[model samples]
Target: MTEEFLVAKDLRKRFGDVPAVDGVSFTIRRQEIFGLLGPNGAGKTTIIRMLSTTLEPDAGGIEIGGRSVAEDSVGVRALIGVCPQELALYPELSARDNLVFFGRMAGLGSRQAKEAAAENLELVGLLDRAKDAVRKFSGGMKRRVNLAAALMSRPHLLFLDEPTVGIDPQSRNHIFETILRLRSEGMSVLYTTHYMEEADRLCSRIGVIDHGRLISLGTPAELKSAIGPPDEVTLEQVFLNLTGRNLRD
Candidate 1:
């Protein structure tokens, strides 16, 4: 059996009367790319935050590499990297500088941080732009740098939240290739995306969530098999069928 690298069991969280995440559970195996699919306000980000150790669950448990998130948050943090939906880079800093800073923040020495910055920037195809100010780069370029910054720590698992949103197609494909390369090299990824096609193409298995509950979990083919037309069906249709057509804020 494949080893489970991360596990979340009956995770729960709430804000006042509103439940942000309610009894969510899933396990990610080594080298697997798991997709978390949900509409806005579906508690995807909440779950990501809890797993990344930024937020604590009110109930339940998260274990990464057999360490409890609530008890060993620092250890969990060390094992995982995060590329948040929002840009976390310093716009005024050069790409290399930003990465170096993040690497240092991850506790690498000056020389080691510089080396990691160079290596990761190269990995994201941004090494040529190393000295360029991030503010002057395009949206896709900024996103690439953000991804590289996350890699400075050499994490075993990665959480990418809308990594391709608002980017040009070429840049999007670049990011996709980068992700595939990481998976090829045995990195586990927890990918969250609104693009059904992306989820279809990249994820080995997907978990669909609505109202903070995991509504469906299956391979893309399996999910489509249940709701898709006999002749053909898109992931979007399966998503709509499971979560409804109502708009979310």
Candidate 2:
């Protein structure tokens, strides 16, 4: 049986009387890509923050790699990496510089940071562009750099929050291939995105949340089978059926 790498149970968080997350429970198995699908304002970000050790939960328990988040935030930080939706690079710096900086932040020595930067830049297909200023790169290139920066920590679990938001198809595909490769190498991921097709193609299992509560949880096929024949039903249909068609904006 696959081991559970991350466990979250009855997670509840509230801000100024507004409940951002309530009674959520799930487990991510080792090396699994578990996707969390939710509408805007549905608390996906909140959950990610809590699990990543940035935000403490109002009520709940979180364990990553058998270490309690509340007890070992430092340990948890070492085991996970986060690539947020927004770009987190210094525009004026070279791609290599940005990666080395992040590597240092993750506690690597200068030599180690530079070495990891080179390896990760190559992994993201950006080794050839490593010396270029980030501000001069295309949106796709910047996105790839963002991913490489996150890997400087060599995290066992990666949190990808909308990692492919606005990149070109080639860059998007590169990110996809990189993620699959990581999974094959025994890395676990908690991915959150609004792109239904991405979740369909990548996630081994998915959890759909709305109004701060999880409404459904299943493999893509199982979720699709809920609304129609698995082969005939697209994930978009299942998502809209569960979360409705109202514009989140």
Candidate 3:
């Protein structure tokens, strides 16, 4: 078995008095697509932020590739790519330019960054639109560019938070294909989404979190088996069974 690419032990984060991430723990193996499946406000984003090193955990530990996030944050940042829930793009800049800017910021030299930017844009099927200003692109196109930017560094571990949000079916499918291809090429992914179907389709294993705690962790089949699946089993059914039907809002 491949070694774990990411590990979180007793991860805890609080917002003033309320706990946002309450002692959640999980491990993601190398080259696997691991899903952080939960509903809105389920602390999915909070866990993601802490794992990405954008936010420090109040209590607990995070290790990526056996390096402590607290002790080697810069090294951790160098080894991972993050595509956040919100679009991070320069509206006035063309897609190619935006990617080049981000790549350079990630420590690549100018010419090398531009080349990498072009390659990533091609991977996302956006090479033809590389010269188009982001402000003029459709929402789906912009999201694709955002993804390309994150991959400019060719990181070993990629963090994608709600990458399919506001995207068309075609774009979503394309993104899913790209994710699988990356995993096949030995890139580990920590995918965060409220979309149950996406998790069912892409994840090698799923970790279900609700109220800042992980409630279930297993392969799709393992999870279904645990709950005693009927003939027609789905991730939605498994999720509802574990988290219940009450509205989080």
Candidate 4:
């Protein structure tokens, strides 16, 4: 097997008496988007938090680029980028300014920050609107800027948590294209989303989580094949089969 770019082993986390992530383990290889699929409160964000070093796992461990999260969290942080589910942009700031500010915060010098901001804006197809205030942009445009900000660090791996949520179809497709292009350029991605088609289209491998546990892991084709006859099953069907069709609060 190829050496893993990121690895989570037996990860466990809890909030008071409730377990949020339990014994979840997975590995992401280079140049692939790994999808995390689940319903609301299925520990998807919790896992991303632990991997991104926002929260320490109550049990288990994570490693990035062969460095353990406990021993070399700073190193791990240096190699990863995170675009959160919520907008992490400054509404009053211009898109260029937002990206530059975040770039500097990620440890870039002023010149480097500015250059990276420009490059990422181009990458997300937002260079033309770089000077507009975030609040004046549409939802899709804001999301583009949010994603561009994360790339300021030039991270080898990126975590995208519901990056297309609440955006129009046009913007959603734009984000999808950007992700594919990133993978082509050798960026590994850990993508979490509730959209089955998104997982089916973007991810080389999909992990289904429910009740704080990883219930299944495989390529979309492999997963779909497992829960149905021949090639007839969809990722959505496989997910509902493994996680059940019941509503989750």
- Where is model 4 poorest over a 10-residue stretch in terms of lDDT? 225-234
- Give the alpha carbon lDDT tens digit for every residue of 115-193 in model 2: 9999999999999999999999999999899999889999999999999998889999999999999999989999999
lDDT per residue as tens, model 1, 1-249: 339999999999998999999999999999999999999999999999999999889999999988899888988888899999999999999999999998988889999999999999998898999999999999999999999988999999999998999999999999999999999998999999999999999999999999999999998999999975524999999999999998888
Find the 10 residues in a row with the least total lDDT in model 3.
Answer: 224-233
Model 3, 1-249: lDDT tens digits are 439889999999999998989999999999989999888888998988898889999999999987799999998988899999899999999999999999999999999999999899998999998899999998888888989998988898999999999889999999999999888998999998878889989998999999999999999888888767634788889999999999888
> TM-scores, in order shown?
0.97, 0.97, 0.97, 0.98
Positional deviation of residue 162's Cα in model 1 after best superposition, in angstroms:
0.8
- For model 4, name the residue pairs that clash: none
**Candidate 1 deviant stretches above 4 angstroms:** 229-231
Task: Show model 3 residue runs off by greater than 4 Å.
Answer: none
Per-residue alpha-carbon lDDT of candidate 4 for residues 1-249, written as tens digits (9 for 90 to 100): 346899899999999999999999999999989999999999999999899999999999888888899999999999999999999999999999999999999999999999999999999999999898999999889998989988999999999999999999999999999999999999999999989999999999999999999999999988987977637888888888889988889
What is the overall TM-score of model 4 with all chains considered together?
0.98
Report the Cα lDDT for residue 106, model 4: 90
Q: Which portions of model 4 show Cα errors greater than 4 Å? A: none
Q: What is the lDDT of residue 145 in candidate 4?
A: 90
Q: What's the lDDT of the predicted structure labeled candidate 2?
A: 0.94
Top candidate when judged by lDDT against the true structure: 2
- Candidate with the larger lDDT of 1 and 4: 1
Q: Which residue pairs clash in candidate 3? A: none
CA shift of 82, model 3, Å: 0.4
